[model samples]
Every structure is written in C-alpha cells, then in structure tokens.
Target: MVTVQEQGDTVVFTVEGWHKLWAMRSELRIPRTHILGARRDPEASKAWGIRAPGTHIPGLLKAGTFYFDNTGDNKPTFLDVQHRENTVVIDLADEEYNRLIIEVADPDEVVALFGPAAAT
Candidate 1:
C-alpha cells in the first residue's frame, strides 16, 4: 500500500510491495524521474492532464496520484495522489515498484509539461 504524508513543504511517499522489494534488491536503487506528455486512460476521472510524478516517461509532470502495473502481470497497482494546503501527496504500496515525485513551481509548469502536444 502507498501512503502519502505532508511535512511542511515536502511530500512524503511510503511504498510497500513484494515486487518493489525484489526490484530494489536487484538494482539497489529505485528508478525515479519526471515524464512529459504521456498518455492517460480515457476512463480515468479528472482527465489527469497535468504533469504528475512518473518514471521512464520524460517531461511528465508530477501532479496528483497515478498507478500502473509494476509486475508485468497485467494486474493493477495501487497509488494515491492528494493535495493538502500547499503540498501535494503521492503514496505507493510496494517497495519494489518504482515511484517518482516531481515538484513544480506552479500550475503553469504542470500544463507546460503534460499539456497536449508537449514533448516527451
């Protein structure tokens, strides 16, 4: 399970999962980075057009929460994205799963990163 907590200006993400553990054991480091102009599920609510935290996909802004299949088994992974006061929250539940958190200055940056036709 992923848990997100806020401490002053920083956002904390707590991730826990078997796959995450195995991956970290193999690599000794978690892969984290910002992704830009990535695709989103059509069925997703809120349209998630803003750049949010992600891995591999560059230019993607780290906004709200996101979830993906980390085990390559086609099963859904758990994630949480929330906003508290001036802070944004991201939480993952799986130690082996890769997670990224992006901190941007304002909404304009989010739009610039994840807006349609934005570069990857």
Candidate 2:
C-alpha cells in the first residue's frame, strides 16, 4: 500500500509497511502538471508483465519500478504499483513514469483527491 499527499503544488506517493522492503523504493514525487488523470481501476494490474524490472508473485504481490516501454524523446516510462484491486490508477505525462497504479484501503477517496477536473 501507499500514501498520497498533496504538498502544495506537488503530489507525493509513499510506500509503506512490507511493500517498502519489496520495492526498494520509498516514494514517488512529481509536480501536479505531470499528472494527466486518475481513477480507480482493478484491471490495471492485468497489464503487468514479466519483462518489467520488478518483483512479483502471481496474483499476490507487485512492488517496484517497472518499465513497459518508451515514447518519442520523453524519458522511458515506469509503473510503480503495490496491489491491483482497490487501486488508484494515475496517468502521468512528461515524467519518467507513464502511469502509477497503487492499492490503498480506500480507492474512492484517493480518486477524489484529483477532483472533477481529473480524468478517469
């Protein structure tokens, strides 16, 4: 699981508990402009693949920075996620990560953090 925070003009997502030990990364931070959209989607996990540089145990766990592919001259994108269900799928742009998929106790509130202007 991860914790999301709005620090003034930026957004920060922090890894917690055992997930920190698995991912080896503590947090992801980016400016609000880098966020394209956010939503709750359990299907996001279906995209996980073995080629990605990360840890996984089938339907049980996922925690790491994963590389799916690249686009244009933009930095190669990444996917940082812990769990699939009850997830907050955040679409990113102009950053090293193309998308962020993380599971939290409350998916609805997490999605609401982006407000109505945010896309699903």
The most accurate candidate by lDDT is 2
CA RMSD (A), model 2: 3.0
Question: Candidate 1, 49: how far from true, in Å?
Answer: 24
User: In model 2, which runs have C-alpha deviations exceeding 4 angstroms?
Assistant: 50-52, 69-83, 115-120
Best by TM-score: 2
lDDT of 2 by residue, 5-111 (tens): 88989998888887886766788898988787778878766564443456676678776766543333433333445556677778877777667778877888877
- Provide the lowest-lDDT 10-residue window in model 1: 83-92
Expressed as tens digits, the lDDT of each residue in 1-120 for candidate 1 is 233344444334444343233222211232222212322221222223222232222222123234443334332322222221112212223443323332222423333333432221
- Per model, state how many residue pairs clash: 25, 0
- Model 2 lDDT, residue 13, Cα: 86
Alpha carbon deviation, residue 114, candidate 1 (Å)? 13
Candidate 2 lDDT score relative to the true structure: 0.69
Cα lDDT for residue 52, candidate 1: 29
Q: Model 1: C-alpha RMSD to truth? A: 12.8
